[model samples]
Target chain A: MNNKYNIFLLATIFTLCIFVLQSVEAESESVYEIRNNQIMEPLVEGLPDPMNGREIVISRIGNCLACHKISSIDESFQGNIGPSLDGVGERYKEGELRLRLVNPYYLNPESLMPSFFQNKNLVRVEKKYSGKTILTARQIEDVISWLLTLK
Target chain B: MKFFLSLLLFSLINSVAGRTENIKGINDNLYDRPYSIGELKSGRNFLQKETLEMELDDFDNPGMIWVERGKELFNSVLEKNNLSCNQCHNTNKNSLIGAPSNFPKLNKDNISLINMEQQINICIVDYMEARPYPLESRELLSLSAYIAYKSKGLPMDIKIDSSNEKFFKRGKELYFERIGQMNLACNQCHNHLEGKYLRAEQISQGHINGYPSYMMRWGVVASVHRRFQFCNEQARAEPLEIGHPDYNALQLYIAWRGSGLLFESPSIRR
Candidate 1:
């Protein structure tokens, strides 16, 4: 009788473990929902910070300044490959900017801008950066907020 | 304060002297030139004054060390046949000078492409009865530097004939195809913005006339393939192994693209 009872207990524990593991994985993977041409929700817990976003725009990690010129910024040698970011806040809506930051390829098939948040479908990514997004969900949100203030 | 002032002065002087827009390609009438001949500038023109000055002086150039080492290896005789590269190649009748200009040519098979380093290894294995030096090894780079040094002033003249036309087309295609997370193609920065600054470094016209060039960052002479690997990594892409056939194809294309530029191998780069 005791042996049978112990077997039942083991089965119950195994089932519980599986359920917990799956829920945890789901929570981590759950990011944002995309609507037509927009990511209609914020991705993380904290409020977006424009100051941090500005840092990322010029930083090596984001390197937006490498291809996009911002005449408002005092830094020299801004690139001219992409459209200038000046008056961008006036040009784009909040959700629209968010979508572009998340994945510009959705809008333009041949967009040179990197998908700052999406990691899948990238080819030949360096081993160090494999399975990692260029920018975090929070960082993307911050960049969106900062870009909205560009006007 | 004094150091800052001096730096300010130096940059001002550099800006005036280091303008790259005026520099022109060697040939004004290159056949089927991609960019205007007047707009084509050698990578050397984009360098800072200090680096340029260092490259101009043979004694001061660090790449010369590899050339010297290669000379020693070229003259050294093997015990079995009592043979040295000097015995065959150094003779006035069969001098190797101006040979590197037309290299990365088709091998005897007429299918496989062989660059300078591979050709050296082939001679070592086939004739000298010795094991080949590993790719990117010090010995191989040294030999390449020496060979390239011999053709220092000669124009690059890679011939992409009917036999090699397929490979040339493949190379050109790869040059324009976007790869990596950065979604960058060679044509994006190298072809479009040769004189523009990407951060502190000025972009060059993506030429391969300086293979086996001395890179200050590595403090060693590097092959064109190794430089390509560096470029791939910078784009956050997985780099292919050195000596890959694809890289050989790219080298052929780049060599042909800048066909009239002088072979400035063992040149300094930062």
Candidate 2:
């Protein structure tokens, strides 16, 4: 019975290691593909939540308000660095918006906007944040969904 | 091969076009100020009314405590060399009045830059034969505060001559180069959006004239380098350690940018 218990424990540990490795691989995997100036695929499985996107835009993780102004948001002291996001929903299609969020540099090399979903090619990132994208794929989708409602 | 050659030619033209656009207002002269005269504003002008009042009233200002400590340190004799800062610097021929505004000056090596804090350390280690104070230490802050206090009301006079031109150029580049997850450059907020609100606080024209100012958040007398580290962290960038060469170079550039602003060390800042 003791020998059987030992085999059972070994099997459980092996299963746990596999689960952890798979999760890490999922995190490192690129979620969206860029085609020219657009990304014609969704980044994650679930439907995007506009409400969650709004919170991220205002919060520090997204910090969109630090440079961009959103008219629908009631927060005071919104920045004016970027153009107002009032009619951004009407301005571009879903794929174009996805490309801009993933990598604004594709359109304008000198654009001051940070690539929220791209981790490579960044310089001087804080150590704790070196390998991390500013936002997760789901978070980027959420932000885009909320931005789409600005019209 | 034809496609490759055409691609290279197109990139060459694009690169040339990009540089001309960026170099619009900048001049070849290192002495040329980024902002024209009369356009510059001291960081003091951005302070809230209550904080401004506190700065104006010496009795109410908490930074005075550090300045007072600095004065004591400046006058105290070192056992190692039987000397004090006041003995050499306060002499009739070498009085340090108006001296604070002239750093980060060229060091004795004449290649690298050294700020008021580093200068103080040099004096202790080289002249007074004493162990140098650690960077951002209370004693070091106090000494710098005392020296800067002597230069109060004098307009800053940073020199960007042949001796320190390279450092000044590096500093200017640093001020404009975007960094971190935020991809923010110093010129974006401080230069373009001065007096604009980020959240609630008004963005000041980034100036070092009021450092080593008393910071309300930390409740301590902070050095300019310490403040730079905080700004880096706020932009989600990695902060270099205190007294890093890059920080000194950035300091030199910022001091030059605000060259005419009056020095106000240990000034109250929130």
Candidate 3:
């Protein structure tokens, strides 16, 4: 009778432990889903080679070269303030890169990079571009296309 | 023992909740009235000279090199065009003195005004038919600092009309907005904590008079917009685009705010 009581108690403890572990895992998974859901929809679309569309990126005239260093091409170019982009294609997936280019600080809240797709209402600006996005939707697409080629 | 443990956990959670509630209340009242231009100036005097040694080797003295580089660029004729800035304007430093302070002026011919840097780029792109250098490029910095250095000692006099009022207001909002995981505002450090330290460096009042100034940390000259870009990044907030309207508005507001402060281009910082 004593042996039987001990076995019952052990089983009850094991069951409780499993239940707690499963609940914690479920909570973490839901949290991750919610975070991903908050990201902008455009970021989920696709990623392309930014180098192939260099003309478009440069013409969008948003000036990514001012801070970034893309060493695989353009021997004359040298900008070290921002990070290097030689292997950015391999480092991040299309969705991750898109989100970063659109709004870098969203991923690393301390990032100094500007948000290209953020609502103008949230960002106060002067009269001319007050309500306007810095880069147009197509321009952002072009830049993203070019960045995807950096691998 | 179980009851005591539960009580401890409950108290810890309650304390955290109370602190969070207090922070939310403070954020809700973020905007009180900003001090007026006159009022703010009275408290902050830009003219009060410090007794610190002014040395050329100091990283803050990028003004000297910028002026030299600007002179070189101004004299050299581009390959596309055999024209130089010296062709139109007198090359003499005395002649060009106080020229840059009156920029971003209205142009009746183009029906659009241009800043000093924009004007330089226009000459380079249109007249010289060359690709304009990037905004924060070393060449741009040297030229801008040289030009601003020529206007050293001139009082800032940026005019604000009804068209620009909205821009000024936006700049003001940005100046005070708290962002980042740290949740710190520009005013929290620049306003209330001036002369204090985050770690080792003492904070300045963020006066903009000496902009297009040299930074020791960067080992190069930088424009006010560049500095603002740096600050935004430091705050862990998204930076505005260079030459973005928001940044331009902030520039205008800063120039206006530091109106009486003597232009101190190439000034040094820690």
Candidate 4:
């Protein structure tokens, strides 16, 4: 009788431990997981490498380098406008960086940075640039990938 | 332990729901009205005409007063510098169109440029060997107003190249970003509520055209930078100092944003 009671108590404790562990994992996964109702889409694949990403950043086509600074290149360029991006990779994970590149204001709604992937239907702009994404999904992914390389 | 855990989870969910509800409330209160570009353009035209007529109504236009003071300062040759503004640019006022508009322009001598206000202060400190007037002081306001008055009606043409792209982008970011205890973005008010009203007065696009305007509220002329500082304060956000590079970038963006609107310096505003 004593042995049976001990076994029963051990089984209950084990089940409870498993439940708690699973809940914690789920909570963490939710942070990185792309939800259906989210304003912006998550990066899936087909992202460009860091070098090409750098090209896109510096180009008027991307314009990320316009306000931010990355120490990888020593081109005679420096802007006092935005924060330096020397070790952004170390500061944030790939998923967080992806979210920021897509729309920095999502995390900090007060961010001056424009939402790169904001749906056009929601955003109002001049007729000429209306209904256009500021950056393509692929470009956004590439930028995120590049940002992750700052470490 | 289980009860405590359940309580923690419940509180977390409640807090998150509360935050979402608050955000929704703010969003609903913000930008409840639509804005039209055509109406904005018309308003700009009306204000410009009214300002031009105002020049005739009062001999004591603040802009004119500043211009007269600037004229005196320009002509007065100091002991250290034998040169006066007359020595370089001559006394022809007509030749000075759009000159002040182009400033905070690049100065060729220092390989670094300064704004009109900075230039005046530099002259006072270095050339005239006089004590530099504090920024926002009557002396500085008068000089900037005088310069802006001279450059009135000239379309603003600030350049943004690779060199300045960073600054431009920063300015753009700042403009759109939300700030303050109210968590209101500039676009939330200026862009979204362009024609709406917080009170009796219409919120006119918050355009920068009539900057350095004579505010009826203040009963004094205020610079664009000063106005920005005021807005920040009103929003309950920390205001950046005048002549700060971030503010300069913001100034550049505001000027560019109000590109279509005609210049109306020293104009009266409520």
Best-fitting candidate, scored by DockQ: 2
Question: lDDT tens digits, residues B138-161, model 4?
Answer: 767776776677667776666666
Candidate 1 predicts chain B with a TM-score of 0.86
| Per-model DockQ against the true two-chain complex | 0.18, 0.27, 0.02, 0.02
- TM-score attained by model 4: 0.52
Q: Per-residue CA lDDT of candidate 3, range B1-270, in tens? A: 546545744653454234323422234332332344554432123222341344234343445777789879877887777887777767453356676655554443634445567767887888888778788788877777777777776766666666556565666565655554223456555554344433234555677767676666777777777788777765445677776666766666556555666676767654
Q: State the DockQ, from 0 to 1, for candidate 1.
A: 0.18
Docking class of 3: incorrect
- TM-score (all chains, Cα) for each model: 0.80, 0.84, 0.52, 0.52
Model 4 chain A, poorest ten-residue lDDT window? A28-37
Q: Residue by residue across A11-96, what tens digits does model 4's lDDT show?
A: 99999999999775433322222233232435444646777677777775666555566667665454433577889889877666
Candidate 4 regions off by >4 Å? A1-151, B1-62, B91-95, B106-114, B126-129
lDDT of 1 by residue, B44-128 (tens): 9998999999998999999999999998998897657777778878757557888886667788888888888999989888888
Highest lDDT: give the candidate number.
Answer: 2
For residues B119-165, write the lDDT of model 2, one tens digit per residue.
99998989999999999999999988888888888888887778888
lDDT of 2 at B197: 64
- Per-residue alpha-carbon lDDT of model 1 for A26-121, expressed as tens digits? 343424445788877776668899999999998876899888899889988787767899999999899889878875755765566777875545
Best by TM-score: 2
RMSD of 4: 19.8
Cα deviation at B34, candidate 3, in Å, is 6.3
Candidate 1 accuracy as lDDT: 0.79
The 0-to-1 C-alpha lDDT of every candidate, in the order given, reads: 0.79, 0.81, 0.58, 0.60
